[model samples]
Target chain A: MSAELKKALYNISALADLGQAITSESVFHEKIQSVFYVITGTFLANRGAILSYDKSADRLITVTQKGFPPADLDRVDPEKLMSLGKNEPFLIGDSPVLAIAGVKILAPLWVRDEFIGVLLLSGKLTGSPYTQEDLELLNVIAHQIAIALNNHSLFMDLSDKLEENRRLYEEMRHIYHGTLQAFAAAIDAKDAYTQNHSYRVAKYSTAIARELGWNEHDIEGMYVAGYLHDVGKLAISNDLLNKVTPFTPEERAEIRKHSTTSHNITSKIKFPWQNVQDMVWHHHERLDGCGYPEALAQESLSDGVRILSLADSFDAMTSQRPYRKKMDVQTAITELKKCLESQFDNKIMLVFCKVLEKEIKGELPEPDILPYLDRDSDLSVISSMLEAIIQELSAP
Target chain B: MKTVQFSVTSRLVGDAAVIYPKGYLNNLSGESLVKECGIYIGKGITKIVVNFSETDLINSIGISLLLQIIEDLKNIKGTICCTNMSKFLQDTFEMLGLIQYMVVFPVESDALQYLKVGKV
Candidate 1:
């Protein structure tokens, strides 16, 4: 076989190398470095560099290079290269701006009208001048390199935009949570006895939902429902809400209207989570059809509504109220356990017990309910009570 | 045919470094050969013998890396000896005119013997 044919075969294989490098699953830097190696190997040039055009910065940044002074490559102007023939290899002929030590060939890379970058190569290691075939081969390699660089530029732009969108979404979510807290504060402020009542319900409901294996989105919805469950109490008079005496039948009937009122208020706005309105509206309904407005019986209730109902009553029982003193932690647990089949779902009760047990035993990383309970209460006693309840509920 | 993964292992015999490069010399993995030689070059050892018995195939990327090693040795005014090259490897090197830059031997022991008796 002739030496020229061998050289030709070598150049063709070099093109194959370029294609493999460009399409490989390797990271961007490694791929570029591989391509640079292919170029240097094909031409047998001891030195070369691949510079990419950073249009935003209007500079030619060196992507990868060897055997050249980096400062000299940094000084090569993108504007001057843009005026050269697109993707065509040319001999550097004493041009003032193109002058660099040992550089014999320069290819200004382009895809369509967009100038991508330039490829610089020093003389061959063999001391042989580049024949017409070498220049042609370089042209083909230069085109492939241009497309790779352009695709990379497009990808980088997309990545930057995606990062910006992610940041914006996080900020908006933070603001949304802040606004919800402010609304809960206003609702709790309507009556003096219920300070942070809405906040506790939100945390407790979130914990229960998490324990039930609800996903983050649904847990977030449960939290929102807990915060807004008493939003309708905002419409009730402060005198009636803070009244110390037992309510007359008419007054009790008026108080029952708040859940329906909560449904009415929440139904007006669009929420991202499913069943927000239904959960807030049906929170006061019971499993046995004996409770207030709508009186949604078992099976008619959703897990979300059941979760909110249990979380609300537990917080209310443990907290100080206008007409009644706050129940201690043990009494509150007993009250919840006694009311389970009548007002709450049995499964939800079990999960609540298990979570509380976990909290008391120091098993949970963040004990949502324990932090809000009365600080003077004996955790050991509460933990024992929870263990018994959990056993009873866990029995097949 | 399955391509062998490229690897480079080196040992010092007297003042020279004998680098054994195994597998198909094709892609960026071949950079290991250059790095192996560079370690000796950095240590002020003037002689490098690359035994290519296991490297049966070579590509442009491989050629580029070989050029880097040759250039590195030239810059240090040192010697490079290539031993146990396959026929294809020898012909490719000869056609590219790279044979003029480095001494070649039929086997690794011959190169080691030559380096032992030759001037530093």
Candidate 2:
């Protein structure tokens, strides 16, 4: 009803506008621009600037400004402003450090003990002196703006830390994969015939696990399990591992101890993915209770172990071994199909067949298994064989 | 209360520009009104008539935008005529002593007639 009441209501509405601008989902620059508009509009100041204190730079950088000489705003010392009271408006007298041409008021923005920024406003356009109420209103607006700026600063700090952490994690992961490759190479180096054997198994297991709808984390675990499954072979004597003759039961028993040794080696290290140890340990186990060491039967073995088991055997069959010549792609598929249900899970076999078929048909962008296979082999014959196997395995 | 988004439209009438501001005129969107006036001022038009018939509500932000237009016209030694103002708008301008900065009219035609006669 009265002019004072109307002006007060307008100030309250301006505060509401400030609140809306700060909380809006707009990006940082837009939100700061909106807030600048609210402040200038509320005070009817013809010239104004919102400056945020960059503590690192120890300078007052204008967030948004208008009608002021840009050079004058740039020269403002944040340290001098910090010496002023927090969130309190100080009339800009002809002080040496703050003697800007047209600025009539400065509110040093602070949250707690931290100096956040400053708000500058020229004389009102109406050519009237700012009342005590106007000063109080500016102080309130300054407080809100300080909080907003401080929140932005905090958010930026958190974002920077998160980005740094993400970069560090990526670096560590690169190094981690490198270390695993070196370990696999070391295991493969024990015997010339099994060169890159661990690498192929890792790829095959990863492809099968992916096709089986395992998440990326689990697929990574499967890959690691495949790579490290023969880590115990590092402990086995080189003569026993590369022996050209068929092993006696005594030597066969000695060779089987590598899986248990592999489990012992991996179990000491904590892996991000669950059951990596179990997957490496039980990779030699069979569903028909005929497997070595633990002899884990059906349901005792996890799908991860099943995948590693199948991948290991497939790579071993396709690769040249000292005891026997390598099987062709078709022969390997037949061997795998024949051994299914006895040693491997039907679901894992089906997924393996489907993935291999996809790789053979040139459907997968990066064929994990096909690259390591004998490239000179007839892919058409292998594709036909895989298609038949997929059909057979997919049948009820 | 539901707010209609603010918008500005303008047309050239003789030597003067007529700006129609619609909706609440209560936020940064109201800047378009100032921008519309600036366009005419840039073209060397000395007179602006803002018809506020559709703008039934305005806040301090709106007043600040009005002040910016008034200041712009003042700097150019030009005239700003506000017409078709609601009662609230008139009272607000009068209370803030802003009525003296510009002429007011009850209708758009009256402001156009005044500007036309003044052009003579």
- For all predicted structures, in order, the TM-scores are 0.96, 0.96
Q: Which digits, one per residue and each the tens of the lDDT, describe model 1 over residues B9-69?
A: 9999999999999999887888889999998999999999999888888988899999999
What digit string (tens of lDDT, one per residue) describes model 2 on residues B16-120?
Answer: 899999999877788899999999999999999999999987777787788889889989999999999999889878777789899998888889998888631
lDDT of model 2 at position B56: 86
What DockQ results do all the predictions give, each relative to the true complex? 0.82, 0.56
* Best model number under lDDT: 1
Residue A207 in candidate 2, Cα distance off native in Å: 1.2
Question: A119-162 in candidate 1: lDDT tens per residue?
Answer: 99999998889989999999999999999999999999999999
Q: What is the DockQ of candidate 1?
A: 0.82
Highest DockQ model number: 1
List fnat per candidate, in order.
Answer: 0.82, 0.47
TM-scores of chain B, in order: 0.96, 0.96
As a TM-score, model 1 comes out at 0.96
Residue pairs with colliding backbones in model 2 are: none
> Which residue segments of model 1 deviate by more than 4 Å?
B118-120
What's the iRMSD of model 1? 0.9
